[model samples]
Target: MPKAFPDRASTGWHSHRRAQLLFSLTGAMAVDTTDRRWLIPPRRALWVPPGLPHSVTMRGRVDMRTLYVEPGSGVDLPSSCVALEITPLAQELIIRATEAPLLYEEHSIDGLVMRLLLAEVARLPTLPLWLPLPRRAALAQLCEALLTAPDIGAAAAPLAQSLGISERSFARWFISETGLTFGQWKQRACVLAALDRLSAGAAVARVALDLGYDSPSAFTAMFRKTLGISPRELGRAKPRTPIVAHG
Candidate 1:
């Protein structure tokens, strides 16, 4: 069973009574914890552990399905958020579950679906996109400044200056720490931020312009390449209704 909210932004920093399997059938989405995050696209889902504070951001008109498993049903599941590679079977299950009517109950099929989901959840590839956003007080503050205005050409340079290092040296340090070039890291950051805005019912053109993209088409191309779907598809999908739990 599941709760669906189409073209919707996830509740901020909250958790649920049951574990949730979050996937998009049509577009891409993002899931974030305090220290970790990932992008979930077609045939990919994020298993959110029960009572774990997190949030999801959809990219475009996304076809999404979230299965809310009861307490005992997922006892063997991982305790942390997992990015699962959705198999064709898993994808079909999500899509079917989403359209299975608002008042559906936990049935034999739900158990079968949950079991398969747990198996696939263990198989998702670890993407490099989930970089740490510096947690040290001073460094985190510096990073926050860069996050707020990523398009400014001198964004990183100023932080490096404040840290008493040359821009080149700072760039190298960022790469060393994040396993991503400075430019790549900034692009990921922009994409993640754009996901949040787009999920919250913001317009594609507005988000693209705000992210400093040349145009909406350019942004859509980037988004599609990154997550395997367009923004329009992510934002306009059907809603998730509350799933009932069975004993």
Candidate 2:
């Protein structure tokens, strides 16, 4: 059955045996690893590699379908957590799998469903909006401030000053800690905040304003460049391929 988690936070640890596919059917959620975080909206799922430490945070009412695949079932998936685009067929498989019994008899429909589902798992598109927070005390504080006010558009110089370090020193510290450039991490933060707001049903124009975009068109253009699709197409996708086989 589908589970709806409202205002919940994960233990933020790794699991031993299961690779999880967490899809949001309603509302929005964010998943964070020690190094990176992803914001997941409806029609999107996050594939978490087994034994990788991570945490899930709910932004609002979250309806999620979580699939715990056997260790080797999702071999084509990445070793790290990634936000994926959910096709209609994949969406149906997850919902059906969740509704089916855990154990299947030999030659059962459930077994076939599981097999087909595994094949489709490799086709999901992993987006690149990873929020990498630096671990240094001062830099981490800087990240926290930006996250707390996602619309804040302060440049690196000001941030460096606030951290009481030369801009070059702060840049080196950020690179050492997060493996992302100052500009790259900032862009990701803005996109993630935009995703969160849009998933909550905010209009694109309004989301642009909230994220400090000069205009909605500019924000949409950037989003398309980063994700290769419009934000409006995220959760409302139709099936590109039909399910041809079922047991």
Candidate 3:
């Protein structure tokens, strides 16, 4: 399905009987589930497992494309939510599928396209664009606040103090629950927030300062290290040649 959403438009919490591949051709979106939030920008997609309750909010005017696959459809899909990096071939396949009739002959060109799309999606590499939420109420609340207003300078000591726990205990618990140190988690949060802002055409300097980075260079360094691409280069990224899918 191909649809357009105006800036800030949201789909209230919902779930589908079929698994979903949510891709945006333009703009960005945030997908929120009970225990995680994914920031999906252009050239990336979110794989939502069937029956997982979730919601999506557009960061700007988004040209959204989605594919719904029935359960036990013979495709080895991911068992959990993931953010996948969309290759050019997968991108083209998705667009083509969206244009085809919803019901098509089993051996027809449309069917072939659908099959290839599923294969491509299944093999697509996942990206680290999601933030894991702690199950503990207080920690979850703190994470929610950070997502709303990320601070790159956030330190474990202060956070531990706020949670009324010793720094060592907080650190150990955080690693046990999230599989990431407090510093690592905080940096990931800031990077995801930066992607949302950068995708919306926010200037690098502005985003850097807003995220509490000392300077744009420092922010760009972190962004590049996390994603392997600088902020400016993301906008200039060129699409790879599409692979031809034959019947």
Candidate 4:
């Protein structure tokens, strides 16, 4: 069934025995798992493997369509959570699937269509819309802090100090934990955090400034480079009103 969730509504840690294809026909949402977090804008979808514990949160009034595929259905989907590029055919099939009878006749046209749906979804390209989380609790804590306070940006010395470690030690730990250098992690964090705010209708300029960009255009460049879409073109986007410059 189609569903609508208000902004910031949460599923609060749930899982299904069957794998799921979660698509937002409008607005955006986030899917969080132990290993990573996915920002699923209307332009993308998330494939969640069966039995993988996850939580969902809405970024706006999300028009959500989901499908539950029985395990052992012979669809060789990714064994882990993945962000996917939803092609036009896949989009149509997803919408159609939601409207089909809960139980379709096996091996008939209806059944064949549902099977093709899985094939099409598996063929779609994967996107870098996921944020790899650190495994260590200390590093994880710091990552959470960065998400809310990305303006604090890549100052490794102070971060290391806060963790009671030397800069060199901090670098080693970061690399060991996430396989990303401090600079790489910072940029990813900035982009992810920006996506969260942007999808929620926050003004692009304000989000840019909040994330320490010198200009909104610069932030736009980074966003386009990383996600291949300008901040303005994200589907159903409604910019939050710009804050006034009144003295």
Candidate with top TM-score is 3
lDDT of 3 by residue, 44-154 (tens): 899999999999999989999999998887988899999998878898999999998888997999999999999899999988999888887888888888888999888
- What tens-digit string does per-residue lDDT give for candidate 4 at 1-247? 5888998899999899999989987778888997888788875789999899999999989999998988888877888888898876777778778888888798776787798899998789988887778988898899888876886246899999999999999999989988888888888878777777877778999999999989999889988988787888775433333323455
Model 2 vs. true fold: TM = 0.89
lDDT by candidate, in order shown: 0.66, 0.79, 0.89, 0.83
lDDT tens digits, residue span 1-247, model 1: 3343455456577889988887765656766788666666544577877788887765655666777766666346667776664555556667666655545455667555656655655565543335466554666676666667655133676778898889898887776666677777777777766666765568999988888888899989987876676888765544443344466
What are the clash counts of all predictions, listed in order?
19, 0, 0, 0
Candidate 2's residue-wise lDDT over 1-247, tens digit each? Answer: 4788776545466564778888878877888887777788777888887787787888778888888877765346666677887778988898888888877764798988777777787877777857877777878887988887776366889888987889999889888998888877777888888888887778888888888889888888888888888878654656656567666
Compute the lDDT for candidate 1: 0.66
Off by over 4 Å in 4: 236-247
Error (Å) of candidate 3 at residue 149 is 1.7
Residue 52 of model 3: what lDDT? 98
Candidate 4 — what's its lDDT? 0.83
- After superposition, which runs of candidate 2 have C-alpha atoms over 4 Å from their true positions? 7-16, 235-247
Ranking under lDDT, best-scoring first?
A: 3, 4, 2, 1
